[model samples]
Target: MLDKQVCRNIKMVLLDVDGVMTDGSIFINKDGEFCKSFNVKDGLAIELLRSHNILVGVISGKASAALDTRCKHLGFDEIITGCKNKLPALVDICSKYNISPSQIAFLGDDVLDIPIFEKVGLGIAPVDAHCLAIANSDWVSTLKGGEGMVREFVDLLLINKLDLPLKDIYKPLLDKIRYDDVAIMEQ
Candidate 1:
């Protein structure tokens, strides 16, 4: 369960890649270029969050061209990579977005993310996350990373923020899709 007050205060959601977004796997091709697998459901969850005006961003200690491309495609509000010390990035995000730490929710899966958990309004961890990380998190998703955990979190946020039943939370997205499809057909 999440604190309704905390969920209501969240204006931005930050994510840690690798463990949180990609199952912590790094695949190198024959050319030694990195490849990553992302969940389509998570992608849609991002779109849903954006439609409701909740900002999303990514912060990772590792840097990769694959991540860069994905962030671009998802239209993240902020992208910070290759930073081992994430607290400064958190401070910077707060300053840049003009929102306090209590207005942010972060999803992370390793020890590197524990500091962030202490600062943010809500800290979420995947079920398969490091034991310490799970222990420190405010909430733990039933699913593992890269397996719709983000979607699950997004559902919870929408449910709480909109004060709607779970079934109704997706109505706005469904309506948007209908509107878009109809507009396209007319064109």
Candidate 2:
């Protein structure tokens, strides 16, 4: 269980892109075009979270121009690409933002992200994350990657801190993203 004060202190949510944001798959075309599928509901959740003043960012190991385009469209606080040593980059972000690890939440899905999870105050892992990753996480998401996992985490965080009912606060955004076809589970 997350402490109320800890959750309240979280001002930023940093996510790993390849496995945590997408399904850990990349499709490159003959012309070197990169392709990825982002969950619309997750995008809406991010918009809502940012509206409440919680910053969101992506730190990706492999560089992709597609991710840069997506980050620009979503208005992410920061997007760090080609970061093989993610922890050092994370340190830079924390320092630049003037926020401590206790004020940040990190969501990751693989072994490389373990060091990050260990350092951040709140470590979240999706259902599809590796077993070792899950073992290190403080909270394990019920949803799979590229399937509204981020949205689910956002909803939980907001509902705990905000007074609004979950559906009332989030349904409109969910509807806009066609979440009816998506299956959200609690694990």
Best by lDDT: 1
Q: Which runs of model 1 end up more than 4 angstroms from their true locations?
A: none
Candidates' TM-scores? 0.97, 0.86
The Cα RMSD of model 1 versus the native structure comes to 1.0
Colliding residue pairs in candidate 1: none
Separately for all candidates shown, the number of backbone clashes (residues 3 or more apart, or on different chains) is: 0, 0
* Model 1 lDDT per residue over 1-187, tens place: 9888789899999999888788888999999999999989999999889988999999999999999999999999999999899999999999988999999999999999999999999999999999999999999999999998999999998888889897687778889999999999999
Off by over 4 Å in 2: 167-187
- TM-score of the candidate numbered 1? 0.97
Give the local distance difference test score of model 2: 0.84
Candidate 2's error at 173, in angstroms? 8.0
Q: Lowest-lDDT window of 10 residues in candidate 1?
A: 166-175
lDDT of each: 0.93, 0.84
